[model samples]
Target: MSQTPGDPRHALPIRLNVDDSDSPADVVDALFLGRFANGEQPYSHSTSIERVKPGATLLPPAAEVVRAARDSDRSATLAQGEGWTLLVSRWSRGADVTVTAVSDELAEKVLREAVDGAQDEPEPQPENVTMGFWYVSPRRGPHRTTRQIAAGTWAEVRPNYTAPVAEAMDRLMKTTPDDIAGRLLLLHGPPGTGKTSALRTLARSWRDWCQVDCVLDPERLFNDVGYLMDIAIGEDEGTAKGRWRLLLLEDCDELIRGEARHTAGQALSRLLNLTDGLLGQGRNVLVGVTTNEDLERLHPAVVRPGRCLARIEVGRLTHRESVEWLGTEEGVSREGATLAELFALRRGSGPASVPAQHDGADAGLYL
Candidate 1:
């Protein structure tokens, strides 16, 4: 299926797998029945289906259509006529629609019905700021595969960093698009030191002008051209101020290290290429990488001066800071605590809450 230029939603053609014995219409009906078992009213008409997609309407390219289907916050409406079916699915990223029939005439008629039925439907409004993790879809190839995961906000993620590191972050957060020359932000720290938390704050602060999307699979992000292209070019926003996109890669220790040249091969090269090289040239995109590796061990090209807008080393909070964060009257004598430990401390007193530290270590996953 193709979308007209003036249309706010982009239509993606979804190929349905029909059994040899079952007709395509029957396969469509089966999808609705499955949803019904799950208490979803997927069907809306006498014999039609209408469901909600995630996210607002932002028509993405063909490569991003399927991702949009699974990620957008829009609705999916199915209207069928004899020998034809027209399906429209909206996603946080965009929309994915399917139109199928034995003949073009029937398909056209179904499409018109689907459109007319949706005329009075209110346009879905997505959250002003969204933070989510995306993974390559197993059903679709990397190019069109995207699944979104909800992420925390700055208020929810209370990151406690060293004064210097916190100051650097504050400066970066205050920097606007015109204040920077480079497009890369590298946050490196030990495990459980709130690197991901800092990234979340950045996303929340930049939400007005930036769209933050996490790449769940950093190993294949740059290695796969189709995936990289879909993320870099296919997902740019259509809004006047929401043109910028931040691609977050978490715990990518191997991709930026000195040995990455040989170990990660093209992955390292492609990452640098997107940082400041010609590949990143016209796109208003920024790359943020969180690694546990030291800067000294990273490729010189990756950490070279002027290559990054902000290079922050986020470490555990100081003794005093941790004491304040933990809300103790007197300062603790221990070295410090990671944000994870602090959060666990806050939760430990609650019902069914687990201890913050287990065996002298943070008791939760890092990022």
Candidate 2:
């Protein structure tokens, strides 16, 4: 329960810049941010991260970058940028904000404004309150570089999906506020659209909802650390929750890479049983896994009626959504193109875009 600031035992650091170009987002030691806001204190006893809104924006470092713009009384929507990536929002105060995929241009702008001031358009408000404000995303690992993906990499994909993105987030992040409110909630989304970034906020929301011990993310493990068959066995007798908590797995498809192998087989079995609610104390054990893959790929048993219990699809974004959000982030001189447009036109029908194709993607877990 006691972990020093440098104690890797409590908060292990993943490699920074896990993949080329991508940083912080992939390396963070997935944590349930809900409790962070309640003043539960961070796992790192020595180093205390400033508490800001989940996804607040920082004004560009322009000349006279006042906290509040003179003309606009509304505590100027916050905006922060690194390179081309830029995250814009205002936190609800006393929340920890960690924005990712910021652009260097925005970075320079922030710096310039920090020293000087520039007249530009105001910043954007949240798509909704649940979306989070004042991001606090840092480097994913010790070696990972800082990023602002929510600002840069993620583009809107509303047109791609039949449901509203904000609604999806609400349904995903919002639960009954049960005892296990901090349990895992899986989410799936296409690449370059913002799955990891969304989870960042989800983690924050989870922490905000309940007094959680730790929020564990399996996505980064699957990607960088690979599937540690050990975790498949279920959590140890001791955990932060003291009883049970959430464990999120993003892009679970990656776990199926070696289904034929003995280790993977055991791993798959462990996942199936856990998802089926066969293991762990049901009191507060909630498991969520998101995949671009279809349900067929997932073991029927795992995703079946009672196993997964709840399954939701994160569809592609509409043309308009892409244009509006990305347009704002990209600072498009002309606004007509959409995120769906860019995804459709620029990229091919690759596996990343066609997540539904991976249907039964989590099927193996049930099998």
Candidate 3:
């Protein structure tokens, strides 16, 4: 065992006998705990986890402090300084870097230095929105991935919506952080009405002030408490500390329908808690849901006054608007046409000639 000379209390040597059979995680744990075991040293300790930015590598400032380190394909590098031990574990998309130091200030300082130049920079295209996606993996449990998706401006796609829907969306598109009165944004209507398109535009419009994330397994999210908490408390990297986030759960007709209490069990309650109950108290998180169910079919608790920021029914365009959109009324119906139908018409395939519709249960496929 070799010990660095210092105040005897803080100079405890990290000496562990290793065997070939010892796992990498076991060794890493020993190294971290050996350096700063509780009550062994007179210094206070703190730890923090940082989600590394995409395309950024852990650099010199962090690497230079290392005394004893280890590396592997899935790596965990442990570094020691005067009174601190830092552990950085790299994963596929990001690294979880944690620092334990003598004081909260020192721990924070070390963490900041380690992650300072490691965040992804904002792209030049404002229409390209960065989105986080949450899902459960069979092997890894709950996980999140991020990507930059192109979402055109609301103005460019305004013609896809009916006049009334467009008017409502205009107000939503112009919303700033100060205008937030509720934490739920509900979009409900028939299929092929451009609900998904409107959400993409909303993401682009609110890119500056908000982060948007899609829960790929929304059904599992509400059912699993641990997964739900992970998402609720997970901070978005590359954004300001207090930035708002919109969690989009698409095609959640059953989760918010009138019989959700009976069908979804505690899922509905958990969803409501995330938006307005104790779980939502100090978090700047908003829940955005898209459903094909009509407004009357949704749960009253979900659409209650003061519970939602916006509840817009994104329906088909009116007959007049549909005629104008297609440049002729050739395939336009007297009632109206969905955005999907209009696109089909423009592509020389009228709605009537389109393939047979699937059972109504899977209407979100048109999105």
Candidate 4:
């Protein structure tokens, strides 16, 4: 028997002795492994797609190469051709397909044919960008969910920032993949100072070359070794491969504050490791963090030289800019206003009032 390079099946036992105590599922799995032990057909190809088109079926196309077919819920199909096997499984959000064949070329061809027209092409929405959300579920452990979010281009939202911040953002918005100098992006500011808004636009500007994902629960992510490893090691599916990924962690004040070493223990160290240490090696990943703490209050390790791609302090607009933005000085203050205040004033409320935060339930996830 021959074995393909890097294939884990090479470690399996040459023969299996199943006892009566073995469960049916275990016996079936053993039998399945037995068929591949000979290594006659060692080539394999696999891909996963998100947002599978509605009403699309994989069974029909899978039948093109195989004689026998088995399907369930019209969403999963399995078929076998001479010296080859194909499997397609789909759920509400996405689908995964895999093919194993005697030759690498055959495996690739079968996979391509099975999913030729099954994926849903993302429609053009200039105001929207697709982002991934990562969180640890009680039942499923670590999981990622993709969503299309509404976000404006930097030009449309330029007036929301002060001059200096706007200038810095101008350069950031125009950044290409080649301009990436470091692994971490730090955004620190007041709660209502448009930090999240800036991140959303950043996602839009870098959409062509980067994939953005938000870790919903940052505290749990770093504290759980298993969860952290799952996220750090997982590969982006389909066309997202080879693209840089920005993992956005919001409101992480406790994790990066000056006292983080005493408070967060290994959490802070793990975060730094993921940014520029051994864990980040060979992984095209960037960490973007939004914190309410002032820059001086952040841990020194997080702000040291050469570790950050950008360290932006998102602040309130100047008084003049606020007056100009509102077109009237009626509710504007001499100290200027945050983006949330501006929105509140526009809605007929006073500048002191906070606008309702967008939870993104109806318009998709934001921030």
Candidate order by lDDT, decreasing, is 4, 3, 1, 2
Candidate No. with top lDDT: 4
Model 3 C-alpha lDDT per residue in residues 1-367, reported as the tens digit of each score: 3455664645555578899876675577577665455433334333223345765545325354343334454566677665567776665546666667777677677677777778555555766888888899763578777788778888799998898899999999999999999899999998788898888889889988898999999999999999999889766555578889999999999999999999999999999999999999899999999998999999999999999999999888888998899898887778888887777788775562343353353334346
> Could you list the CA RMSD of all candidates, in the order they appear?
10.7, 17.7, 6.5, 6.2
lDDT of 3: 0.78
How well is each residue in 1-367 modelled by candidate 2, as lDDT tens digits?
4545765444643322346753232222122222232223222111112233334233333322212221221122223232222222222232122222233343344444432222222243343211211111342131111112121211342233334655666565555455232333445444434455455555445544432222244433433322332333334322344333445555677553333234354555555544443454344555556666654555544444544434555544454554444443232223333233344333343322233332232322211
Q: Which candidate tops TM-score?
A: 4
Expressed as tens digits, the lDDT of each residue in 155-236 for candidate 1 is 4444467678777876887777788777789999766677866776677678677778788898988888888887776753
Cα error, residue 88 of model 2, in Å, equals: 42
Which window of 10 residues has the lowest lDDT sum in candidate 1?
60-69
For each candidate, how many residue pairs have backbone atoms clashing (under 3 Å)?
A: 16, 100, 0, 0
TM-scores, each model vs. reference: 0.66, 0.38, 0.70, 0.72
Looking at model 4, report the run of 10 residues with the lowest lDDT sum.
Answer: 358-367
For model 4, residues 201-267, the per-residue Cα lDDT tens digits are 9999999999999999999988999998888887755326789889999999999999999999999
What ranges in model 2 sit over 4 Å off?
A: 1-165, 177-184, 209-244, 254-263, 276-278, 326-367
- TM-score-wise, the better of 2 and 4 is 4
